[model samples]
Target: MLNGKVVAITGGFGQLGVAVVQGALAAGAKVAALDRAPAPAAASNLGDALALGGLDLAEPDVAARALDEVARKFGGLDALVNIAGTFRWEELEQGSVDTWDLLYRVNLRSAVSTSRAALPHLTRRGGGSIVNIGAGAAAARAAAGMGAYTASKAGVAKLTEALAAEVKDRGITVNAILPSTIDTPANRADMPKADFSRWVAPKSIADTILFLLSDSARDITGALIPVSGRV
Candidate 1:
């Protein structure tokens, strides 16, 4: 259903980010993958699609140029998925206030930068979709050491809701997917003894993003859909 469409993903080289890129390819869309650091060799699977590295998406001008590059390459952009973010396990009790600022830039500012940049291209296409990666932790009562991460993601949820309303008449749909403990290699390494089976799979999250970007979900804007699986 995504044939001929162009979709861009930020944080597009990470565990879940790669999954979303592969998912978009499977749906026949052209994908642009951007990251704050260079993608590993594994990302060669993207095979000539747009891939940018070391971009500070926290900077609005850089973010805008990235999207402009996509449009220049693809003629137009159809979807944008804000997946660039960071996770810090720090608590108010002993964690440094510096973590709060770092999380704000990596999580909240990244989304704000990308979404603002993509808005014009999406609008130029006559209509499109924007998906933000929100944490389930942001919705529930945050865990003890999750304040920084949760607060930033809460900002993402609010961005999705407010942007959806702002673009209601412009045919753009903004939504966020909230996932609980995505089962990445990094997460597994950190929680070696945890029940991996209960965590959401990257593919599942990618599938949810596909649904939101597809025509089937045209009416599903301003929603924060959770993809916890059995978690």
Candidate 2:
């Protein structure tokens, strides 16, 4: 059901973002994949989709220009997935203030800036969807070393709720997905002793995100859908 939709995904070069971009294309949507890092060589031939790199989503003005460019190139814009964010593990006392600052800039700022940029274009479509990636870890009582990261993702959850209320009348739906321990290679490396089977798969998360962006989920907004795989 996303056929003909022009969807944009931030953090498009990442493992999870790569899953999302490929899935969106498979579902017959025109896609614009944006990331601070360049696209992998394997993604060079994405048929007609746009894959751009080095575009910082933290800068609202730059994000607005890029989204406008996407609309111009893709004919129109329909959906955006703010999957760009960073993760850090550090206790409050052990962490430098810079860690907090870095987390906010990379996680919260990216989503806020890009969602603000994409809102008008989505509204121009009469209605559209915005899906954000939040961590389930953020909702639970803070783990010993997750203070900075959790706080930033908590901001994302709040942003989703508030923005959904703001744009409900405009036909734009804003929502966030909270996933616990995504089964990515990086996570596997970081937590080598953990059970990988319990972690959520990138493909599973991508499928859910795609569904949220489809017409079927048009009535769903401000929902923080959790995709934890028994974690």
Candidate 3:
């Protein structure tokens, strides 16, 4: 479904990000994998299937540089998946301003900076797609120990909506996936006793993102689709 497309996936070294990259590559899209960490071992499997880069999406200039580098390397940019995020589990009483700021930088500002940087390149391509990874916790009422994380994701949701509106006329489609609990290895390890069967798989979410990026989803924008699985 993604053949001949050039796709940029942020947080490409992460479990979910890697799955998305692999899926896109399998579907025949040229992929650029960007993350804050150094390239991961998956690059070997990608061979010419992927290009990897280190990027700090919180810094606007760095984000711009990363986008420029991707465009230059890939020859063009068609889709951007903002999957980079940090999870902070802390109570309001225990969470300091620093904690809030840290989450804001990673979860909120990073998306904003990267999206801003990718806009022109997407426009140059005559239109592209942006899929943000959001959280279901953002839509639900706040939990006791997730104030900062929830707030940051709420910001992401709002940003997705606003950006979609801003770029609608330009032919860019911006959307978000609100996942409740992703069944990643880390999550399974963190909660070994919990029911992992109900959690959404990374590949499943990646498929939804691929669909949103496809030409068939041209009319879908400013929408936050839930991918909770059975959770």
Candidate lDDT values, in order = 0.92, 0.91, 0.89
- After superposition of all CA atoms, the RMSD between model 3 and the true structure is 1.3
Candidate 1 vs candidate 3: the TM-score winner is: 1
Tens digit of per-residue lDDT, candidate 2, span 1-231: 789999999998888888898899999999999999966565364445698888989999879988999999998899999999988888878679999999999999999999999988888889899999998988899979898999999999999999999999999999999999899999999999999999999999999999999989989999999999989
Candidate 2 overall Cα lDDT vs. reference? 0.91
Per-candidate RMSD, Å? 1.2, 1.3, 1.3
Query: Candidate 2 at 177: error in angstroms?
Result: 0.4
What candidate 2 gets wrong by more than 4 Å, as runs, is: 42-48
Superposition TM-score, candidate 3 onto the true structure: 0.96
User: Model 1 RMSD to the real structure?
Assistant: 1.2
| lDDT, ranked from best to worst | 1, 2, 3
Q: How would you encode candidate 3's per-residue C-alpha lDDT over 176-211 as one tens digit per residue?
A: 999989998889888899899999999899999999
* Candidate 1 residue lDDT tens string, 1-231: 798889999999888988999999889999999999876575386655688888999999999999999999999899999999999998797989999999999998989999999989988889999999999889999889999999999999999999999997899999999998999999999999999999999999999999999999999999999999787
